[model samples]
Target chain A: MNRHILSVLVENQSGVLSRISGLFSRRGYNIDSLAVGETEDPTVSRMTIVVQGDDYILEQIKKQLNKLIDVIKIISLAPNVSVFRELVLVKVSATEKNRASITEIVSIFRASIIDVSNSTLTVELTGDQEKIQAFLELMRPYGIKELVRTGLSALQRGDTQISQTVTE
Target chain B: MKAADAIVKCLQKENVEIVFGYPGGAVLPLYESLRSSSIKHILVRQEQAAVHSASGYARSLGRVGVAIGTSGPGATNLITGIATAYMDSIPMVVFTGQVSTELMGRDVFQEVDITGATEPFIKHSYLVKDATQIPRIIKEAFHLASTGRPGPVLIDVPKDVQNDRLDYVYPQDVSIRGYKPTVQGHMGQIKRAIRKLRNSKRPLICVGGGILRSKAQEELANFVTKAKIPVVHTLMGIGALPVDHPYYFGMVGSHGFAHANRAVSQSDLLVVIGARVADRATAGPGLFAKNAEIIHIDIDPAEIGKNLGTLIPTVGDAKNILQQLIKGITSLATDQWVQNLREIKDSQKDVLFEDRVGVNPKVILKTLGGILEDTAIVTADVGQNQIWAARNFPVTGKRQLLTSGGLGTMGYSLPAAVGAKIACPDYQVVAVVGDGGFQMSMFELGTMAQNGLPLVILLFNNSRLGMVRELQNDGYGECFGIDLTGNPDFIKLVGAYGFSGIRVHNDDQFADAMKTGLAATKPFLVECIVDPKESTL
Candidate 1:
């Protein structure tokens, strides 16, 4: 099995995102994490997709993605070279007895408490996948109530764009 | 100008002399503007025929073919042909009408998401929400369809967008950021291929549809001659070289010549040009040129290693790449390989035998070949008749044969001939079809009649689906759904559509009917009564 990140540039059109993700699900491939947002140009959107599969699945995904006309470009970003981040918000149960301890744990993990209730604390954190997972695990001992994470968003460290002009 | 009028103007500017379309509820405004346009429109009976004809036109002449249909069923009917062109990489731009923007998702009458339906098939599609986007969308659609491994492009126009007026501003250039197709091959790769070609004692050139699409036939022939290589063809790659050419080996596939397959197996080096090594061409990936060092030349980068992966992948335009390769190559002496392929071809020449009193499709197609010349364009429907045409039709040195090779669309020939004959008026156009596939798009006879296209409809009546039956007979004990219980009397049926019908039950009568059909100024239908169980192979 191989894990690859594909930074997809697509025309900002209705149902385009649904079409891409739907194609993956229908074709029976795994999308580990998918994050999409407006790029520098609003007319186009950038999607950072994390997928896990063997060579056959990778080739199929590449061919299938190219077939989608809404997709403008797909650049396979190397995990070692590019920086990616994920944001997670977790609400953990905290009694007055362990509130000070939980606050200390939050400070150590560099997480900020967004809201403080008498029984629960909502902490927001931003980090790489590993950091987020570790933080979630650390807070689990304090009784986790809820958890939400924005999927990975990444950008290359270089200046080149996959949006090179194609002449007819 | 109205958006519809602007569209007509844009089509005119694109030099689209002819287009095929059918009228329906959603596309009224576009059709209304077309009444006064200079471009000629051939009204097809069904929406499916419109797309088929357009693709036929594109296949015949290497220009982008235009086709149109309205929403719902009209657009849905075009799906098969769209997929056909997509698979074959035939350049076609299809315009489909949509419901008004307000009623797009409201379950409105005659409404369907045409772009969504065609998403998997087309190279690109545009759903114009704004009227001002019409001009740019039209330009982009044409460019996308005809460029870079040509395939179908669709533009779905909402009814409201067509009605709304806008200043017509056509984009002079299409600068798509992500669609750069390499035209010139990497020089280093070309040099390496030439060196490999020069060294190989048993070298073969497997030309395909891409050579025809790229109009690189002359260059390919030149390269083959200079390299002293034998040429093998896939089904879609027919006519890349003259059939009578000394080095031209016959097609390679299931129904293809045994010699060609033998050549692919024996060759030390296989130079594949512009053709996707489809399963039909390879049979299976296992024994397909396994011993040969394969060199793949294709326009699409994705297609290079998609199927039977190659050792040397040269991605670029065939003409440009061959032109570059020709410069460094002098003379490749392969007299023994050439003689070996010649012997294999000579052994397979007398394979197909004749039946005097029955309609042998092979005999029919061969007889048609005897009557027609290089100027004739034969569009074949899917199944057994297509196999006969592919196997027996002696057409070469020109882009004359068109078939739904990749998609295997059942009813393609009749409408395809309509479009081909319309595209090239002087050429003798013929539609070779089986009884099973004939009924699928037989209504296009009316389109032929209305347009006055002097086409010969060669109906091969086997009284069953020959390929399907062959499969059942070989694989299953009993035939269930392959037989046609009540096929129409084609000769009599065609007479009502302004065609002179001639029934041929004997082999001797086929040539005469073809002569008559070939000479006729109006439409003619020559029906061949083929044996029901005859293996097309």
Candidate 2:
């Protein structure tokens, strides 16, 4: 299986998201992660979806997504050519003794200490999937109190725009 | 004018003469508005029947059928019908009355998230929030429902929105940014398909419901005649070509004719038009047309390679694609191929069924086909009855065999026949249903009785779900839960709805009974007591 990152542009309409997610579930296609936000045009929304499937499954996914009335366009962003990032907030149980070490690890990973309490330190990290995984592994020794993640959001590195391209 | 009145006005503007619907509390205002309108409303016994009936109307008339229902359970009931229409690509517009805007999402009395529930199946849906936008939404709904890759579209209107007053002016045109459908095939792809067809010694044209949806029957006929190519069809493509046409082979697929499947398997070039090639049509995709180089033609680009690989994917409306193909290609020497197919078809012509106890359904349908007018419409319910009708009924001239081919929903025929008869009052309409399926929608007898339609109900009484029984008997060597031992006396049952019927026990009794039913001035039922041992093959 291969992981595919698809950048989809859709109408900013209510129920469009449900339509996309419902399609995935109904067709038995798995979604690894999905992030949606408004684009330059308020009437349109861009969704960055991460999925795992083979070539046939990937083609089926793209074709099926194109069939949705609200979906305007879809482009698969290649991993090497795209800039992918995910934001994760990890609240670690840090006592005064281990707080200094935790801060040192956080600085090494270039993560920010977003929030701090007597018994916990919340670290905010934004990086690609690999970087996020590495940081989380290093923080595992310090008992994790709470964790949240904004799934993989991606775009091409160059000047090419998805909206301007005509789809088949 | 009230938004409800505007909705009626929009229907009138769309040239909708009738609507199949049931009234409920949430739609009281809309029903009140309809009460004052000239459009005729057929009150179905259930909301499901309304959608099925509308489907029949749409398929028969080549127009978008309209159906209405009130919310929660009523909307939920339309689900099966909507999915059926979606699968078969039938054009229909369905409206459901929602609880007032404030009551929505609150689990109030008679409230459901219908739009969300139907998202996967519906072509497009609108949950009307702005009363002033009612006219535009209605216009767009009709346009979307009837356009490329036709299917059911739903509009859920809140009760308060229907009551809200607004000056409505229906839009003259619709332009949905994300919904433009390709109408013409790419020229380069068409040329590639033509070249492939010319080079192949054994070529076959597999037509589907898209031919009918695009009204490309004439084009298909012309193309086949000029090219001398043999033709086969999917279940939904039954009426695309006359059954008796010289070049037409039977349907292809699992329950399809052995000869037709052979033709598909043997062909070197297979041009599939307007078919998704679903599992039922292909049996299994891996081996289907393995030897053939496939050229998939469909209005929806997504369907081209969904199931099977395509050598040349031509995306466009079937009618337009066929026209393009016809313009580019000349007569081909496929005589040897046609001869081979004919020999194969002839060898499989006399399929012998086991000697059972009662009337043979195959003979009943064949005889009925002979008796009916060339333009007659037959709607077959699911299961054994559907296969029996699809195989035996000779669909000629303008005749149609409407069924829930995609969803295989039982209880479709009776109400669909109602819609067909209403749509084409001059044509003879027949509902071929099995005992189990008949009871599923027999309540529609009241709808037929009230309408005083001159229709025929051909009920095959096997007293069991024969298809499931056959599968059980084949797979597990046993049968269970397939019995309908307490099936009512169907003739007496129809009489309860103020209609007359006749029961026949054997082959000799059917033609006469059918003749009598057709001669009757009101809705009539002809129940043929089929042997429980009868198999679909």
Candidate 3:
């Protein structure tokens, strides 16, 4: 099994997100990461999903998902030809001794400190799955009090946007 | 004039006598108006059950079933039920409440996009923006839901729209652009089909759910007998052809009869009726009717060549198309074909009746057939009971069988039987449900009692979900959540609903119990404690 990045287009409506998620939950399939946002058109929205399954199973899943009324289009992006990233906001407890080291590690991981208090440092990081995993592992030694990660949101390597393919 | 009054008037115009629903803040207006209306409202414990009950009602009643729910969570809860009905092609109208128009995009409390969420599942959907449109939309929703190939429809009315002041003028006609369904078949295609059937040696007839939807039972029977072809039914096609009918060969599916599959594998010409060749029915696309020249007939053009591609597709209702075909058909000598089919039947003789602990499912079905009237509409649930009834119930005369073939939904029988009883009060309505299936829809017993509908429910209490147990035996190696170990006493439950109920523990009591249940002028439940290990299909 491999992680597949599927871009789905659906009508902008309520409970659709819950319904889609409920389907995965009911089917006993674990979702790795999911991100949904409004498209250029207000009526339609795009959702990026990272799920691990066999290619055939994934195809069947996509077909079933496509059968949902709100879902308009679903396209699986090739890993090599796509750029994927996830945003994670982690708040870590920092002492005088670990502050410098944490800042150095954050710079190495291309992360920025979004918020810093006397006792805690909230770092905002954006990277691919592998990079995010590496950063989280490094931050493990330095006490991560809280961490929230957005699922993989991907775009094709080239300038082609999903909107250009179908006008509707 | 008030919107609530308009809603009541709309329901009266549509001829809806009973509706399954739960009260909600957004729908209070309609509910308030319903208090004074002639329509009987069945207040379900949950919104999801309301929709399921409506699905059951539609399948049993042979008309559009109505269900109502509130905004947000209530609407979302109805999604599964609506999808179930849609998948099964059971006609139903689901009414849901929405936040007022002003609160629609403001992220207000209890606001959801019901129309968009339900559009894919329903045959059609409407969002009532103004109260003036309620009457017309309600009329059209029922019309679209019941006509041609049936399916569920949704009408999401905002709180303001439900309470708005508008003159209630029921639409004289429903005229919507891009919504004309074709009713008649092409003469050329009809002639071609007749010519092909006449020329073929190994001919077979495959009827789907469309025959019942179109109420073309007489035409189908006449055509089948005149054509002299063996009939194989999809799960949805059960009861369209009588089980005792000489040419009937049971069902065709993964769980279908061995002889039926062999017939499909061996037949040269296949005449497919209203039902679609679903993946579950065909086993797999690779082994499905590989050699047969399929002549697919359906009212909906999209269903034709959808699953297994059709060779000769005739687009029209089953009755109309069959009537035309009957006129144009030329007689063929298929003595060899008939002999081969009979031989296969003899070779694949099912040993379902040999099992004895309680009454064999096949025997129970046959017994029920003998006891019930010929004009009864039998609604069956999924599981072994469905298979057994499909194999044994010899549907004849005006009687019909209703099932959730496409969805294969459990807990379908009780509510559907209740609905059917309401639709045809004069006709005997029986719901043949397995133990697990009956438990899933047991709440409908109260609804039946409340409405004074004398619906006969036959609960095959095997203590286990027989189909799931079989699946475990075949694949899982263990049956986990398959048993109804602590299930409520169905008879006691019905008694609590103030209806007469009977329990049959032995084979001798089966006929008597059935007679008592049928004789009751009020709703009744007959729980027959059946043998769990028995395989009826």
Pairs in steric clash, model 3: B56-B416, B60-B420, B61-B420, B208-B275
Q: What would you estimate as the lDDT of candidate 2?
A: 0.93
Q: What ranges in model 1 sit over 4 Å off? A: A22-29, A55-73, A91-105, A115-121, A139-146, A157-168, B349-357
**Model 3 lDDT per residue over B1-537, tens place:** 898788878888888888988888889888889998899888876677787778766765577889999999989988878988888788889999899998898878888988777755677677888788788888888878887667888999998988889876788998643355668998899988988998888989888788877877778778878878888988788768777787888789887888888899899999998988888679876577888899999887666655766789888888898899888775567778878888988888566445467766677788888888988988888988888887787787667887777777788777777767766788888889998888777766667877788878888888998988988887878888887789877667777889878887776788998888888899877877788787756
User: What lDDT score goes with residue B379 in model 1?
Assistant: 91
Candidate with the larger lDDT of 1 and 3: 1
Per residue, candidate 3 scores C-alpha lDDT tens digits across A96-156 of: 8899999999999989999999888999999988898999999998899999988888887
Point out where model 3 deviates above 4 Å: A1-168, B105-109, B352-356
Q: DockQ values for all predictions?
A: 0.41, 0.74, 0.04
Candidate achieving the largest TM-score: 2
Q: How well is candidate 3 docked (DockQ)?
A: 0.04
User: lDDT: which is higher, 1 or 2?
Assistant: 2
- List RMSD in Å for every model shown: 2.7, 1.4, 8.1
Q: What's the TM for model 2? A: 0.98
**Please, what are the lDDT tens digits per residue for candidate 2 over residues B1-537?**
999999999999999999999999999999999999999999999999999999999999999999999999999999999999999999999999999998888899999999998888889999999999998888999999999899999999999999999988889989788888999899999999999999999999998999999999999999999989999999989999999889999999999999999999999999999888899989787788989999999999889788889999998999998898889999999999999999999888555676777798998889988899999999999999999999999999999999999999999999999999999999999999999899899889999999999999999998999999999999999999999999898888888888899999899999999999999989999999888889898
Per-model TM against the reference? 0.94, 0.98, 0.75
**Whose TM-score is higher: candidate 1's or candidate 3's?**
1
